[model samples]
Target chain A: MKIIAVCGMGIGTSVLLKMNAEKVLRQLGIDATVDATSVAIARESRDAQIILTTPDLVDQLQGLPSEIVPIEHFFDLEEITAKLSASLL
Target chain B: MASPKQLSNYPALAKAFADNSIRVGAIALDREHAIEMAGELLVASGRSTPEYTQSMLDAVAENGPYIVIAPGIALAHGRPSEAVLEIGLSLVTLAEPVVFGSEANDPVRLVLGLCATDHNSHIDIMAELATVLGDAESVNTVLNAVDSDQIRLLF
Candidate 1:
């Protein structure tokens, strides 16, 4: 499976989200490809199974082939862990 | 092999804060002032040009406050542009939290200004900060820190 962590510019915030998401996938003993992309790119593409982003940005991705998983708290690892388990496991 | 904690790049982000660029006080006004202060912290430390703050402000006006990365914490940054001078970090805790009008996260108190020379250069430090601030308990600890030393020692 593949995941994309997205934010406004795919510069700072999205990169952080991508790293944490990779760590979560590793901790769960799951193998998946995760990429950090900008909101614009994520909106135009559907190259990943799930697009992880903050709740607010989800609206901007109105019609997309990929499922948008809006994370409530970006810093919390436990939240990421639980979200991944529920969706992928 | 070292544990996951050891592998984290908290040290990289820690150095910027170690340069004594943090300001903890009751800085009032609006979100722009808070962001400007955070940017000033980076500029005064020689990490960025004056254009860095303007770039940050422009990004907000164009994209909204997507910088509010977490509850009570705002990670302010702009793209790798001419405004960027160097890689830097600035942590400012306000006495009164300022609202950035983010739909999800608002009333941010921790303004972490990220000045990256390029888009990819600051990824390591940004990831490190995210890891270090991953837990509510840790976030609370940093929020309650009495001095810059206390917060700097966190990373």
Candidate 2:
């Protein structure tokens, strides 16, 4: 599975999201590749099966083929676990 | 399962904060001022040039307040640029929370400024940070820290 973790600049928070998501995926025994990118780039990623991002950026990414998962708290693993499990597992 | 304590989990981040990069109970008039204060610490630490500070502010202007990563925290940063000299971090805890215009996560009390010369250099530090910030109990401890020394002890 391919996933994209997106933030505005793609350097800071998205990287955090990507790393934590990878950790969660590993713990859950799910296999997936997560990429961190800017919203502009994420909009163009047609192959992404899931896109994890903050709740606010969800509107801008409207109509993308990937499942847009709105992450309210980027740092919270429990939240990430529940959200990702609901969507992926 | 219980969340692991943040003790000694972020050695690099602890060292970065030890280099006079942390300010506790600071006052900032607005979100911009808060971000500038965090960036200034990075500049003082020689991790980035003064221009990098403006780049961070510009990033907020262009991208909105997505930096407000959690309910009461903002991780201020811009892309790696010529202005960045090395990988570093600066932390500022505010006397009064400042709103960054995010409805979900507004009135940020903690601002963490990060600058890296490359994409991969700061990833580990950020990962450590994610763990530290993820737990509300840990976040509360940091938020209520009396001094920089107290904050340093957690890492």
Candidate 3:
């Protein structure tokens, strides 16, 4: 599966989100490639199975085929674990 | 605290804290005030122009409070541009929590300001920072830190 972590600027929190998601995915034994991208580029990733981002950015990703997951706290591994599990597992 | 191996791999983080860019138990009147303090730290460290501070506020105004990336922390930054003279990070732990209009991460007590000359230069710094902030124990230490020395020891 393919996952994308997004923020206004791809270089900041999005990268952090991508790392955390990769950790959670690994712990869950889920095989997926997670990429961190900007708001503009994430919209073009049509093949992404899940898009993890802040709640405010969720509407910006609407109409995409991917499951747009609204992440409340990027540092919360339990939250990320539960969200990804419900969506992917 | 980050592991010794982790800090060894990301020496820039240790350098940043050693430079005294961290303010512990600061008082911020509101969310914007918290972000402004973070920006001021970057400017005080000579990492970015004074104008970079306003740009961070503007980004939050335009993009909302997504910078509140964790339950009690907000990382303030704007796009890479001329305002940034170099890559830097500044951290401030508020004496009183302030709301940033984030549903999940409201009342942020820690504000981290970041400035980079370009997109890729700070990737390692961000990764190191993520490792430090990702742990709840470390987050607690950050929130309760009484001085910058205590924070520096975390890395």
Candidate 4:
């Protein structure tokens, strides 16, 4: 599965999330490709199956093909993994 | 500039983000100017100049809202050289909603301005700020703050 961690800059928190997601996927024995991108670029990145971001930017994503996961705390790796797992199907 | 502990206070937070070179304030204006305002504050803090401010704003404008960094807070910043002489912070509160390209679960209220001299240093500060913002109570306290001194005590 492919996941894209989206945020304002796509450099700091998004990169952190991508690393945690990779670790989580490894622990779950699921092979996944996790990438980080800014919200603007994310809108056009069709390669991603899921987009993770905070709640405030949720509304801005209106017609994207990827499913959106709103993360309240970017540091909550477990929560992020859980949400990603449930959305994988 | 103030220490991270002192930055916990509102006034200190404001002043910490400020320097003789940077101008910070609470502005009740249109949301479109959010980036502009943030840039001005950074410049006034003596971190950058108008050219740099404009570049940072342009980066965000091209990339969408880089403002929504925290839960309810937006940290508007760009490449260090876009407009930064040194690392600095600035704060601005909006009276109303400003569309900052966030998901439905989070809305932005407070804007923390960042002017970093380099990527590594910026990341360090960003990590620290993220840790502080992850605490719900602390963030709530900052949101509820009325005065700068009150903000200091909370930190």
Candidate 5:
């Protein structure tokens, strides 16, 4: 599966999430490609299956094909995993 | 690196400084600009000056990801000596995202502006804010909030 982690700058926290998600995916034995980008760039890149970001920016996505997983806390691994698992299916 | 325990001190910090504070309008344009704007509020509320604001940015820039703690939130702060008259904190949310550096996962939407009189005090508040922000649900509540009053309710 392909996943895109998005924020305002396409750096910083989104990259951190990508790193954490990579570790989590590895532990779960899930083979998924994760990329990070800004919301603007994410809008342009349509190859991902899921988009992860804060709930505030989730509403900004007016029309998009990817399913958005609004992440409130970037440090909550369990919550992030739970949300990811639910969305991936 | 302070543990989550160290981060739980944000509430007292908030309570201590919330009085006599003014809430500003939300910036819908650039997220990075929100950080600066929030910092300005923090400085103004604390009766600080421009030097303090520059110092805050410098501290964050040197320290790396001080503000971009979580996903969408960025807590911009600096050493208290830079321009702190008193301890202060402020919250700013962007209607849109703004880029910071070149991290594959940045463009922060929420900025929690902070200013402390010293490093010790700053660490305490940082710890608390970190803990509070670690919760997905709580972070969502803050992010989805419409006004400063609503944002204050979360703290």
Candidate 6:
């Protein structure tokens, strides 16, 4: 699976979200490659299967090509897992 | 992102916080004050310029498209611009939590400001910061830290 973790400027929170997404995907026995990028860049990304991001960016992702998963807390592993469990399959 | 294959740099981040990046036990009248103080720390360290600080405030006013990442924690930053002098991080632990107007998370206690020469440079820092912030115990330790020096030790 191709996943992209996105945020405003592509640096801080998105990196964290990407790390957690990859970790959760691995722990759930899923195989996926995740990319971290800015929301502007993420909008143009066509190949990603899932776009894991914060709630603030969910609206910006409207009409986009991927599944937009809005995470409430990027620091919570369990929350990321719970939100991603169904999507990975 | 910095490098997908690289491990998170907790130690280096710890050292960086110790040497050049922290302000703890601060009091802010509101979220903007908290953000400004956090941004100023980076500016004083030469990591960011005054315009970057103002931009941060503007971003928050624009409704924090990315600042509030978790409950009680907000990370403030802007696009890589001339406002940034170099890549740096600054942390502020507010004595009084202030609301940033998030439904799930509000009354933030920690405000982290990041400035990068480019977007990619701070991705590694974020990875490390996430490691520390991800753990509830560490976040608690950070909140309880007496000063900037102690917070660096916790990192």
The candidate scoring highest on TM-score is 2
lDDT of 2 by residue, B10-112 (tens): 7767755635888899999999999999999999988899899999999889878888888989999988999998888899999998989988899899999
- What DockQ does each prediction reach against the true complex? 0.51, 0.65, 0.73, 0.22, 0.09, 0.55
- Candidate 1's C-alpha runs over 4 A off are B1-9, B135-137
lDDT of 3 by residue, B12-100 (tens): 78755436689999999988899999999999988899899998998889878888898888989988899998888999999988989
- The A-chain TM-scores of all the candidates are 0.94, 0.97, 0.96, 0.87, 0.90, 0.95
> Which residue runs does candidate 2 get wrong by more than 4 Å?
B1-7
Which runs of model 6 end up more than 4 angstroms from their true locations? Answer: B1-9, B18-20, B63-65
Error of 6 at A60 (Å): 1.5
lDDT string, candidate 5, A1-82, tens digits: 7888775545444555666666567867789977866667888877788887766567655478888887655677787788
User: lDDT-based ranking, best first?
Assistant: 2, 3, 6, 1, 4, 5
Candidate 1 lDDT, tens digit per residue, B61-119? 87778778778888888778777777888888888889888767788978888887776
Q: What shift in Å separates residue B88 of candidate 3 from its native position after superposition?
A: 0.9
Model 1 error, position B146 (Å): 3.3
Off by over 4 Å in 4: A1-81, A87-89, B1-25, B101-107, B153-155
Off by over 4 Å in 5: A1-74, A77-89, B1-11, B16-25, B28-32, B60-66, B102-104
Query: Candidate 2 on A1-89: residue-level lDDT in tens?
Result: 89999988788999999989999999999999898999889887799999999877888788999999988778778899999999987
In the predicted model 6, the residue pairs found to clash are none
Q: Candidate 1 at B132: error in angstroms?
A: 1.7
Backbone clashes in model 6: 0
Query: What's the TM-score of every candidate structure?
Result: 0.88, 0.92, 0.91, 0.64, 0.54, 0.90
* True lDDT of residue A28, candidate 4: 79
Q: For each predicted model, how many residue pairs clash, with residues at least 3 apart or on different chains?
A: 0, 0, 0, 26, 22, 0
Model 1: clashing residue pairs? none
The predicted structure with the larger lDDT, 4 or 6, is: 6
Q: Provide the global lDDT of candidate 1 against the true structure.
A: 0.80
Clashes of 3: 0
In model 1, the Cα lDDT at residue A51 comes to: 91
